[model samples]
Target chain A: MLYLSTISWLQEGPFALYRWNSLKEDLPLFFHAFLYTIGISLGALALAFVLGIFFGILSATKNKGAVFLSRIYVEFFQNTPLLIQIFFIYYGLPLINIVLPVYLIGILCVGIYHGAYIAEVVRSGIGSVPRGQSEAAASQGFSYWETMFYVVLPQAWRMMLPPLTNQLVNLIKNTSTIAIISGADIMFTANSWSSMNLNYVPAFAFAGILYFILCFPLAKWARHMEEKNKKAYSR
Target chain B: MIQMEGVNKYFGDHHVLKNISLTIEEGEKVVIIGPSGSGKSTLIRCINGLETITDGLITIQDIDVTKKEAPIRNIREKVAMVFQNFNLYAHKTILENLTLAPIKVKGIKKAEAEKTGMEYLERVGLADKAAAYPAQLSGGQQQRVAIARALNMHPEVILFDEPTSALDPEMIQEVLDVMIDLSKINITMIVVTHEMGFARTVADKVIFMDDGAIVETGTPEHFFTSTENQRAKDFLSKIIHH
Candidate 1:
């Protein structure tokens, strides 16, 4: 048992509002770590979007073989845990003598992990487009790919924006998982700060605020885009 | 010209089209009128290879449509379709809808395609709406743009599938006027519609179908006033008012 002081918890020594001043000197480091978080998320999101769109289109195709191939990829990634996927890349790859830096591993793991869900979003988005659109395009002598690119995908993209933005938000949060591997992202910095200063509550609270800052505008933009599309298409 | 020789189509054992043998000569306007589920639309769809035939053959402009190796895009260049819903590309402007195929498929220069597109837009009385999207236009205006989009391809045959059925009653005349003008241009057309007045005026021949088979084939006057088939007479009595 430890001896108790007479002071209240909230009003006590270093855990109060004055503790934030101690963090003022380390603000630059935290900001840089925040940049690393954003950079990693963007890099992962870009890779995920490309892979997702490709797999999504593949799954939407009428070809049995192509759809089967896409199904395998989607199911495999989506079913596995993100943490295991990170470790597999970070730790398992070296068993075969292929080593990658932690940042690259984080990007690859986060990208493919979220790419599976994005593919599902894309598949359903493309599916949601009216069949008549493709028929009309084909009737106009547009080839399969031409119809997809020029007509179908544009409409699908509009339908897909909301869900895709949700995925981006999730990707941003998921970046914190990289902390387990000691990746130098914002969450990693929060972990280090909380441990050294024993300021777990404030450090995590600030980190959560930073994540909110990153994701809030994206969610707002998705809603705005959805409203714009609804108005544009409203009869 | 379009020809279907004993064509049959099935949607998983529900025969949508049965032994559809028909010929539409170049410059001839053929109107197909029928009750719902009678396969009039499917017959026209077969000519364009939009619905694959289960058996027999369909030929449009002397190209076999039943061959799996057939160049469908090439076939479609000569055959264009106007849908009941006026399936205009919603993301594109009316001008872009008209110009896209001409530029992309026909390999016409963009400027030339735009000129051709605008000319057809003028023909449909929608030149003023070229900058507008399909959603911005009324149902009648959209149908007119659909017609212009088909015309931009310079297709030998245009298939109209209930082009006026989806329009408001007051809006029907505007689309019919465009169709009437198109008929006067001597381009071959196969129209599936409930508008008997249009058929009586513009059709070179009229075909009546029931239960996936042709019930009667005659001049519009014959089908409208003197058909011997009981089903055709019943259908006419049910649908025709004036």
Candidate 2:
């Protein structure tokens, strides 16, 4: 089990410190790799938020074509393995004569690929609103978009924040998939350490802990907000 | 002013409302009572376009509601509806729930809307609970807030759908009291409720519906005691006995 391996790594940590601590070289590489992972993850998330919200709202609207396109978009990304998706963009973009810059492509592909799932999360957030809110606003003589923006969406956004944040944390964790595609993210650095030290246990476990450090606070805060909003908005 | 001429509504030919025709004068108080699934709710909902009529022209304050281009939103803005569930914006404080429509729809200033909101909240005896969320209030109190929400629109007409059906027996009286007071105002109203006592006290015209058809319409005293329609008499007897 992975638990036993982590324990073995814990037993071997002082050995790793004795072996590499004086070199001080692995420390900078670890921090640099962590920054690259966060940077790419955040960049992709920003893009995902925009595209997710844009198509999410569009897909939910009265337009039939928009709904279909957004539906296809959601299913395509969500049903496919994200690792395969990263590989496709990394390897396939070149076939189209689109030489995507290595790091930029990672961010772009991850953002767009995850954006499909994020869109559904966004759509559900919007859908959770009662029909009466829209009807009530409409009855007040506001236009459809106006009603959505001012009344429906305000309430929807409050509800959607938690789920959207969850997507963000997952997106960060998913950045590890980039290692499969030569994206030079934090996981790749850890892999290099594994190869160099012949210590897969310490390397992968440290990688997981590093991701946890980045993701735990965010996930915790999201859950906290969800509970707080539930109380605040309870009928 | 409101008019429904030959209104025909159906849910996949279930015949929910058939050839419903009526006229509501300004400042009139009309109460509709009937057994379940009798279309009383549908009748009132049609007035507000909450339920679409298959065939008919419904005119409210001279606006033809059946016409899509004639501005249903405009009609609705003038005719506020207080639902049986007390659909207060659950996320908002009582004051925010009251003021949102006024500020957004009427382009009223926040201070002006809040002042109006507070006045209605005061009338409903929840002025002190302005900052309180709808969940914090009792069912009767929430319904009262719903009334205040509707009234703040300064509507020409208001619709009530089974206003007291959800309340506890002890809590029903407070909501009914607010409605009784509403009856004294000039706003036209069409209430769909099973509350026979409320009908007896405040309704100028009491309409009885059965199986999607109007069985009888009359003054409360006449309609209650001396109805010729067997269904109406039966209904009165059953409800009174209960």
TM-score of chain B of each: 0.98, 0.98
Model 1 pairs in collision: none
| Model 2 CA lDDT for position A121 | 77
Classify candidate 2 by CAPRI docking class.
acceptable
The most accurate candidate by lDDT is 1
Candidate 1 residue-wise lDDT at B70: 93
Clashes of each: 0, 0
**Judged by DockQ cut-offs, is candidate 1 incorrect, acceptable, medium or high?**
medium
Local accuracy of candidate 1 as per-residue lDDT tens digits, A1-235:
1225434544555466556766777788789889999989999999999899889999998899999999999999999899999987888889999999888888988998899999999999999999999999989888888988899999999889999999999999999999999999989999998799877767788889999999999999899988888877533
lDDT of 2 at B51: 75
Query: lDDT of all predictions, in order shown?
Result: 0.90, 0.84
lDDT of 2 at A19: 42
